[model samples]
Target: MKIQYFIPAMIYSLAFALQASANHPGSNLDDVMSEKETFFQAINEPDAPSFELINAQGELKKLADYEDKIVVLNFIFSNCAGVCPLHSARIADIQEKINSTPMKRLVQFISITTDPGNDVGSTLEEYGQTHGLDPINWEFLTKKADDPEDFTRKLAMEYGVKFQPEEAGQQMHGVVTFIIDRGSRFAAKFHGLKFKPINLILYVNGLSHQEKKQKQSFLVRWWEVIYYYFIH
Candidate 1:
């Protein structure tokens, strides 16, 4: 149900051939391999996903905005009276821990709605307040929940999240929280109930360092200059 930004395998193969012809031996292969590896790691990494859907101030959000920040993503539907509250409480504990540490700016948390139709902006706001979540640090997002589906399904599938509607609203069998590193790749995953605050902090800190090094790489510098030159 998710639309992906990645090009199809055939397209990648064609592009690889063309790039290979235009570049040095194995240069294209290296580039293609690196790109493929990043994608592979994103999905193959335990409990990690490539993207998430968020509603920031009543609008949709993509993964790019938090590219430089350590991101925590999870799925929760507001109306659930069961496991969701406990899940949120655990997340709250993690947030409180992160808020007390120096990793604040380097970290961001996103909780997406599994039942987007009923979980509108106002509902999300109230839920945030009820849980003592800081709006700036925590984002509760939703989208239209028509039969055709919307951003919710796209994002959920992209991240491999699973949720099903129930009597009151919906229930989620997926209890995992995705940990996305700086490259927008999933770095780790934790269960909603058993995830540790300290471990998350350590993982995020390690990712921050990795992201810093990747940015400082020679290729990234060259791309930055080229990007600015064309865009500016």
Candidate 2:
């Protein structure tokens, strides 16, 4: 009958209620958003294609390094005069919006270069600045010395985009912004620059909320088990 004894019961009830709401039909936010947003394509690949690349600081980085954060990923080279720049600029815009809110800490922005040969050293460090991408939660990645020249290009293809090199230092490719949810689930993609930035931000917010609810449900169940043993 004590107030403290009722705390666990309240939490358990609330957790179950949330779980029920989450399990209700049409409750999948990713699928709902994909249908509502014209350019957003929702996917359910269990594991995103992995990659090990180098950051601008010459340090090694991998897809797993961002395990707990939502990833906004794209591919670009420093020298392109075409859609690469446009795609990066669009990402920069999205990053700015996300950073303005508390969600900044929960998201990471990644740009992998298809032209590692030219996008080395200062080129890697300066590309973000030139394109308005902040270095706070963003990285411009390139292949390492031991990697093949087309290493990142192949990885990009795995993500469903191709960076086919062409004459005059240009590469032919479509622009796509991939959204990888926490735990490396390939959640969705925003194709082309036509998609509204707000739509992507909202989708990411939905994913973040979904993850929070899952964690809360787990903690509630854990607390209930501990309380049951303590009462006896």
Candidate 3:
């Protein structure tokens, strides 16, 4: 075949292969949707719960502030010596991958402290630095003074997470990472420290461009079938 000669199936197959090589984006197909469901619990509520807090730099940060970008939300305490560190590392890993993709600018990473009392000021900043979180698009936040102190702790509760103080100022809490869409709607959650970071990254990649009609399409991976039937 001449290089100038091309067919619809060939072009579609090439484009689909390129996309598959990168991050798998939004899919309306039941199998893909079901796979996402098996990995992250969906919370497509009318409105996601909101919060008001300050980042490590003392800048005001809120849920509404990121209404235009997909938000990856997590909970951690500066003093945590167990799963929290692992959780932050997981986020860092996910961040590195997201940074390598176009979705990096389309996403915001937020870590809310469950122990706001000790996770403030330079302490939070140092924690992020130690974990290699770039401050450009990432923030380590806690409750501001005169904000009831327990503001973030209770906020975690609203996200269905709980934290109990332990010896040496550490905390015992559930490990979960949440995803919120551009419209401020809670999308899904990658629970525990074991969920693949790539899954969340791909999930965010999908949500970053997902639309109503795309989510209602007959098959999101129809090109796979196309290539299989036409080329194979």
Candidate 4:
């Protein structure tokens, strides 16, 4: 896939700081390294939660259903007249730039509704249609209304997204996106305000290439031959 690249200010800022502090301790660079390392750990960790959600078609789908592909997931309610629309539009812009990749192979986008009570299957369908989402790959989902609280909590904890509900159906939450690699690892997190689809694709493509190389190491090749040569 032809990956789109867009370097944002924050990336250059953090990277420069980390580069300066790579080998020095008890220096200003150390603090920058610590912060960058913390961010890296948060993104590169192996655990990515998979949950059941009702898709726009009213069918059950799991995050695992899209295994072996780069997945971008975000949480937003259809009723959200605030940040949700802008975030979705930003994602659409990114998709347009990376139009060469196959929808199923290179990327999949999912939006999970925090306001499950109102964002039903039909509602999600309407929302996707309203946003001009490419139904071939993009999906809007709502958790079952019966005790959506548990699912909501699971989603928040799994993706490290914070969703706070308020009276009159208003929510105070950050616009966050999670990128899951082909191996289903939490590869990156994009704060809503800082989320740029091209940047996400570039970083995820880097991770995908890295994982592919790691799988082809000599140790992996030897183990694979030992484990499967006799059977096949």
Best by TM-score: 2
Q: In model 3, how large is the Cα lDDT of residue 58?
A: 88
Output the lDDT of residue 75, model 1. 77
Go through the candidates in order and give each one's C-alpha lDDT. Answer: 0.57, 0.77, 0.70, 0.59
Give the Cα-based TM-score of candidate 1 against the true structure.
0.64
Per-residue lDDT of 60 in model 3: 87
lDDT of 1 by residue, 104-178 (tens): 676798888777777876888899888877877889977633334455656676676667655655564567677
lDDT for residue 140 in candidate 4, whole number 0-100: 85
Candidate 4's TM-score reads: 0.68
lDDT of 1: 0.57
Please give, for residues 1-232, the per-residue lDDT of candidate 4 as tens digits: 1212322332233222222111111122222223433332235556578787787677888878887667878888877868989888877666554444423246788888888778875787888777867776788877764654647646875677677778888777777777776667666676755533534544443333332333224323432342243212
1 or 3, greater by TM-score? 3
RMSD of 1: 14.9
> Candidate 2 residues 72-95, lDDT tens each?
999988888888888888899889
Q: Note the residue pairs that clash in candidate 3.
A: none
| Candidate 2: residue 18 Cα off by (Å) | 13
**Pairwise lDDT winner, candidates 1 and 4:** 4
Off by over 4 Å in 3: 1-33, 210-232
Runs in model 4 lying further than 4 Å from the true structure: 1-42, 102-104, 210-232
